[model samples]
Target: MDDSQKRETQQRLQSCLPQIHEIHSICQTPSITFGVVHNGEVIFKHSIGHRDAQQTLPANDETIYMIGSCSKMFTSAAVGILVDEGKLSWTDPIRKYVPEFDPVDDPRIGQEADIIDCLRHSTGLSPPSMLCLGPGGTILTDEEDLIPLLNVMPAVDGEGKERFNREWIYNNYVVGLVALIVQRVSGQRFADFVRGRILDPLGMRRTAVRRSDLGGDGNVAAPCVKKSNGRFHGLSDESWPCEEYTPLLAATGMRSCLNDMLTWCIAVLDAERSENDSSYQSQVPNNPLKQMTRVRRGYWTRPADDPEFSKDAAYGMGWFRADIPSSMLSAFSGNGFSREKEYRLHLQHILGKGSEAAPFQVVGHTGGMRGSIFSVFTFPETQSAIVTMTNGRDFGDASDFTAQLLIQALFDMKPTLDLASWARTEAQLAGSNYQKHIERPWRENRHLGDLERDPLLYVGDYRSFNGRFTLSIGGVADGWSTNLSVKFNHRNASECPLVFYRKDVYSFYQVDEDKWKIQQIGAREYKQMLLKFQVDEGGNSVEGLWWQWDADTKPAWFENVRNRNSTQKGAPFLVKSYSG
Candidate 1:
């Protein structure tokens, strides 16, 4: 591209500022830092909103934000490095490195699943529901405990069957297992390995794999979320800090700045370009970037009528591959700010003119955590990329929408619909629906009245079938009210009062404090856990309780193991005392 084309591109991007600001304001996002990379160089950079909840600190190029699952690319690259060295092969079975990794649900999965199967998400493992942390918002089990828990975990089909190499199920635990393999094989901590091999080499000095490594960096953006009141609130540092994510660090615990991320993107784009050159030999043998970006599984197919049309959308090791239609380019003709009219015109103005309706391939990934989200796109054919990072979550898919808008602008693709309106409407509907879903049980069954047995009978220690989790029910007295609440892993901080829904079922909502502390980060949809008590054969004594935590699969059973001596015959059994 010549100077004239570059100026024109800049002008088009400049025209997008108003729309970007409008979306940011509407979403109530705390901050967004983005950059565009063209021909191996950063062509444009911009930042909006504030880095802090107080709105005193301005976000800029140097403000660091957690990239969340975007760290998967780095982990895959680390594995690729091992492959290049012949230290391990992608075909190697997981049991080879971790002998204890035997899933009892499907012994064949434990015996047959190879590295590629896990990376490609074809291992058939159900998505991990409560594996990362206990109800207290802290790491419960360590590396050793993960293996045994996984042994009894259900498959994607909810039956003890294997889907290995057949279906795609996004399992973060399996990816964490891959990182563990990297640690064991490379003989270095996962964080240390990634920093030395990838971050240092690429000169991403601002990137840190662990929070401890960040060490007094005042420029780091505070994780936050926008509330219904249209205000941003910063989450507590202890909520879900990087340190607590040690076991899954490789999966989702890297913090980086716009400048550093742009550097990383350039490296990936350069690697892809070099691979296409027959005469170009990489200094690093076998080049993991090629393997990481190579499409391995097809996940979706969008028809031509779709606004962001793509015939085939697939997943590689960590990146997603898709094609954008070329015919969506047209001219802009509209006036001022209207959700329907303005967005369409803005999109058209950026797109410029329509040409042949062809499609071009692009690869990237989207990541989210408690209060941060990211979207990255690399147009290998054009040697360009877009990286967007925001320090807010749950309000909407602000980062992703921004990336899509930029992609259309860069490629001169016209607007097929009012994307901004669509995104905002969807977000609002999702939040509203989720609130109703959680309240449905109570709303429907409240008239059924309390349980037949004493509520104290449910008080006890309950353990999961696999013994991976423990729940304790106890009485809490606040002011004049006394109620029974359950706590995960016996942590007092995680306790939530149990409300009677029906005769044998009781419901409780977790993370209420976290919800008030921040604006519902991490959890896109709030849910309530229901517990159903089981009576012994005589129907006089409590035996166990069935827990319905995740609504997707079967409810897990937890045996009540209260000691007989802990409670006297019919008085309120107060095993533990809590003050108001």
Candidate 2:
């Protein structure tokens, strides 16, 4: 495009900046850095808000932020590189490399599923609760530690035949296993291999696979949480240690800045061009890019009436592929400043009236963690990309919403719905509902009487059926009274005081202040952490316990070990002897 066209596009993008700022303010996001890549170059870039909670340091293009789960594509690229070197095959059985790769409920998955099945998330294994791998949880720091625990992590209950290669369950544990395979087959650490093969080659000097690499970098954005008072607070390193997440680093641990990410996006776009036209030279090779973006599982089919929405939505190796209506120089035929029509008028102001454009293929991925969120959209057909990253994970989908707004403006697509109003309403509802859910248990059970038996009877060490994880119930003094609190494995930081609900069931919310703060910011896991105790025959003693770790799945039962001499430590049982 000529200078006039570039100037028009820049002005149009500039007009959308106010809306971006409005959304960021509405969502209470701490920081955001976004850019648009066109024809293998960054044509537009913008940054808003502060990198720190104090609002002292302004976030810029160079401010580094954690790109959670967005690291999946890099892992996929690494695997593709291995395939290109003939070091591994997509069809090879996962068990061929890791002998302990077995699912407790379905051993056949380990025996039959291949590398592609795992990469495409077709193994029918739900992603395990990250709490299970927390500091004192079952899994250790090393990637290899996941192998033995894999056999105990249950598969989706009803997905029998589909568990092999039919369903898309998005298992991070499996991805970590894939990384381990990369490490073993390539004879190098997964992070080192990715650094040498992908990051260094692309000149992404600011990007690093390990959080420790960014230790002394003062330019890094601090992860933040928006509290109930509508203010952002930065979390300390001890509260949200990125290192404890090492086992799944290949799946979620990656830190990068806007400029480097833009460069990465351009390389992907250039690779797409090179794949189509042999004469076109790409800065990066086409082999891994082609393999990484190839769709392997269908997850969504657009409604027939929604012409502007995504269609045939599917998951590729790590990216999501969809066909969206794209246009150039389209005019707006509507009135008013409401979300529905105003976006179109904004488009018409930029690209004067023209015909509707054809549909274009778009591939992208979203990454989210405790206090960070990211979104990237690559228009392969148009050779353009849009990326947005934010330090605060708020009640709304701020990152994706900002990216979608940009996509609408850049493509000049006709307005089909009011995105801004819809997002705001949804965020409001989610926040309200979450607040209600958090209070419901205490509200409903406040009238119930005390426990039938002494709470000390339930104090013991309980091990899961597979003996992979342990939970210890101990006593905590509250004024003159003592209450029972439970901790997973031996993590004192995760200990929560149990509230008596009924005869044998009790509930507890996250006691860790940082985790509770994260839930306030919409993390939404463990809103109701219930524990049910089993009574032995004749009700003489506590025999077992069941824990509801995930709200969606059935409670996992653990046998009462009563092993006083066990290596794990817990508060001494109070009121030594209990009447039976």
Candidate 3:
């Protein structure tokens, strides 16, 4: 591209900035920073909104925000590096390295599935509620906890299947396991590998595996949650310790700034040249990046009922691919500009997709965790990319919307949809009837006798295969009030008196409100819906406790390991009780 073309593109992109700002404002986002990568350089970059709700500090390009699941792309690249070195293969069985990851019982996908199956999310695994233990109840801190998941195979609608072939399941646990594989093969910590290989080579100085690595600099943007009242509050747990999320570090634990992120995108966009670039020789090979960005999986058919599935999209190793039809672009533009029409024709002529074929291909990913949201996209053929990050929780599709607008603007095409109006509507819907700890009303149809079961029968130590949490029930000083205790992992171990809210429903009010109050499997079911104890033939001894939440969310069962008549801290219990 020549200077005239570059100048024209910049002017068109500049025209879209005001609309971007309007969307950010209407959506009540605390802060947002966006950059446009054209012809191997970030020609247009802008940062808007305040760093915090106080509106005291203005955000800039240097402010670092958590990139969340976009970190998966880095992990996929790391695997590509391994594959390039002949150290691992995408078709290699996961059990080849991690013996604990054997899915032998699942007749359908166990033996046939390989490492690539995980990268493309063909493992048929879904997000497990038990694994989410971090802020916003969506992140995991332990790698060892992943072992128990082998016992529980991926199921569609709660039934084991003969095969899981077509459907896509977005799973973090599988990605976490991939990080472990990287560790086992590379003989180095995952974070160390990413920093030494990916970040250092690309001159991504502002990027780090953990927040503490960057230190307590005010340059790092604080994670903030937007309340229904159009206010923002800082997250209580400011730092996400990397050691706490060893396996998950590759899945979601990346922190970066606009400049570094732009550099990363440029490196990806110019992968062919970078393969021979001496700057990347000693650190990361570009061959891995080339493999990482190529499409490896296909998901063309959208759900029949889903109205949002109008476009065709697929998944690469860690990135997503979408084929944008020129006809659709024409419709979005309302046949407004002759330049846009010409540009659309140019794309059709180059990609061999005329007015009838899909003219453009977009590849990128979106990420979010707690108060941080990020999006990164690059047109491999056009040499254009967009990277945006905001300090807001509900920034899911907002990134895609912004990227689309910018892409359309680059071509000088007018957008048909009202993005600002859509964002405002989303904000209103998010704030609509915001309530804390939503639970269902008690079912009064149960017999009173059944409700008055022997409290002693429920007092025992129940355990799951994960061993992350232990459910313990013990008698109180009065022997009347049931004492409930939960030892979850090494970090959270607490006990409290069980407040009987309904028949077989107990609430541990002692748990932090933020952790439990915000934990909802569904719109109606809250965390207060404790285990419904399963009884034996005579209904005397308890066998197990089934979590009776909606099957669509928060589904797990704990079998009674021991029925100790007394809640002793030692002997059969073999676990420390929470003193508090």
- How high is each candidate's TM-score? 0.84, 0.84, 0.78
Q: In model 2, where do residues sit more than 4 Å from their true spots?
A: 130-142, 159-162, 236-247, 284-310, 326-355, 416-418, 445-447, 450-452, 510-515, 519-528, 537-540, 563-580
lDDT of 2 by residue, 1-580 (tens): 7888877777877878888887777667888889998766689999999899888999999888878777887887888788868898888999999877877667778888777777777776765554344432223224444666666555655433445564557677777778888888999888888888888878888886766566575888887877766667875534322434444677777788999889888877775576567797666643344443342233332232223432445566667766565221111101112123324323323221232666567778887765778888888767799989898865565787677778777766565333566456535644554446555544565436755577778888887634556788897667876698877666665566777767777666633444466533222344336677888777778877766555554556666786334664322211122222
- Whole-model alpha-carbon lDDT for candidate 2: 0.66
lDDT of 3 by residue, 1-580 (tens): 7999889988988887788878777656678888898767678888888777566788888888888788888888888778878998878888789766655346445556677777777776555544344323334335675655543544453454433555677776678788889989999888888887788777777887866567676777767766435567666443353645665677777888888888888777666345445474322343235453333334333221122423545566667765554223222111112124333322221112223434566677777666667888777666678888887644223444466567666655433334565455445544432332232123232224546555667777765534544566665546455455433333342334455544454544323334332331222334434556667778788875655323353345666767443343222211222110
Deviation from native of the Cα of residue 406 in model 2, angstroms: 1.1
Local distance difference test values of all predictions, in order:
0.65, 0.66, 0.60
RMSD of each: 7.0, 6.8, 8.1
Clashing pairs in 1: 328-414, 329-414
C-alpha lDDT of residue 443 in model 3:
27
